[model samples]
Target: MISIAAFYIVVSVLAYVTYAIDKQAAIKQRRRVSEKSLHLLGLLGGWPGGLFAQQRLRHKTQKTTFQAIFWLTVAVNVACLLSLTLYPYGG
Candidate 1:
């Protein structure tokens, strides 16, 4: 539905924005966004932008754990989107 698409778009944009801020903080404050926060966002359907940030900002890609977790996040988000598309609620 349009709502779902909008949700995805909003979340992706938020993820990119969050990652950009995190990158800036890392440069200025010597700290990155908390792993929990990043994971939560990705899990909530921000994986694409998280991935973009990972590649663009080069943040959180060095750790093997993060790599695995990031992929998992992407997978989960995709699955959720698929479900939303295939099974409309009360339709």
Candidate 2:
């Protein structure tokens, strides 16, 4: 449980920072972080922070396609997390 919590915490922080960087890049018209990478981060247990960053930074909230995919990734991550907790391997 501790390990799982720690993993989420670390990944969430990474996701939040990545979103911030991506937002700044967009404003500056610089190279942007790919949508796939953002979604991958969320799928890897960072959706909470990614969601927070979206509202907090007002980033990535305008695209319906991205929103749809992001929510799908969130659902998938939650399902995986529940499975790991409820039916831990080899138990």
Candidate 3:
């Protein structure tokens, strides 16, 4: 089994990569990071990074739907992380 630390590290890397891609897309005005990819990244615990990219790159911040979905994803991921930490293994 992968350790929690490893899992978070992977998530952070994914977040950074996705953020970079999204930023590039914005520079080219292409919107490369689709709604699907945004949702997927958020579900994977990368919403914070995604949100930062959105602000930093001035991308995808105006759509109400995107904001709603993104925040929901963040909440879900936070819930999952809290549960995982609060629950003991092999209980």
Candidate 4:
């Protein structure tokens, strides 16, 4: 349990940093992080950080398709967490 928590924490922080970097890149008119990568991060349990970054940085919050996918990833991540908690051994 502790390990899982730590994994999420680390990944979340990384995801948040990725968003910030991508945002900065956008401001500079440079190459930005790919949407697929961002979605992958969220799928890997970083959705919370992704959400925070989206709101706090005011980035990627306006695209309807992106928001839809982001929310879906969040739901899937939450469902996975719940399943793990209820059946740690994969009953």
Best by TM-score: 2
Which residue window of length 10 is worst by lDDT in model 1?
A: 1-10
Per-residue CA lDDT of model 2 for 1-91, tens digit only, reads 5699999999999999999999999999999999999999999999999999999999999999999999999999999999999989836
Quote the positional error of residue 47 for candidate 3 in Å: 1.3
TM-scores for the candidates: 0.82, 0.94, 0.74, 0.93
Q: Give the TM-score of candidate 4.
A: 0.93
Displacement of the residue 18 alpha carbon in candidate 1, Å: 1.0
Which candidate gets the maximum lDDT versus the true structure? 2
Candidate 1: tens digits of C-alpha lDDT, residues 5-75:
68767888899889888889988987677888888898998888888888998988898998898888889
Between candidates 3 and 4, name the one with more favorable lDDT. 4
The digit string of per-residue lDDT tens for model 3 on 1-91 reads: 9987677667766876787887787788885867788788878877766777778767778889988998999999989888888885724
Q: For model 2, how big is the CA root-mean-square deviation?
A: 1.5
Residue clash pairs of candidate 4? none
- The C-alpha lDDT values of all candidates are 0.84, 0.96, 0.78, 0.94
Residue 89's lDDT within candidate 4 is 100
Residue 10, candidate 3: C-alpha displacement in angstroms: 3.8
Off by over 4 Å in 3: 1-6, 26-31
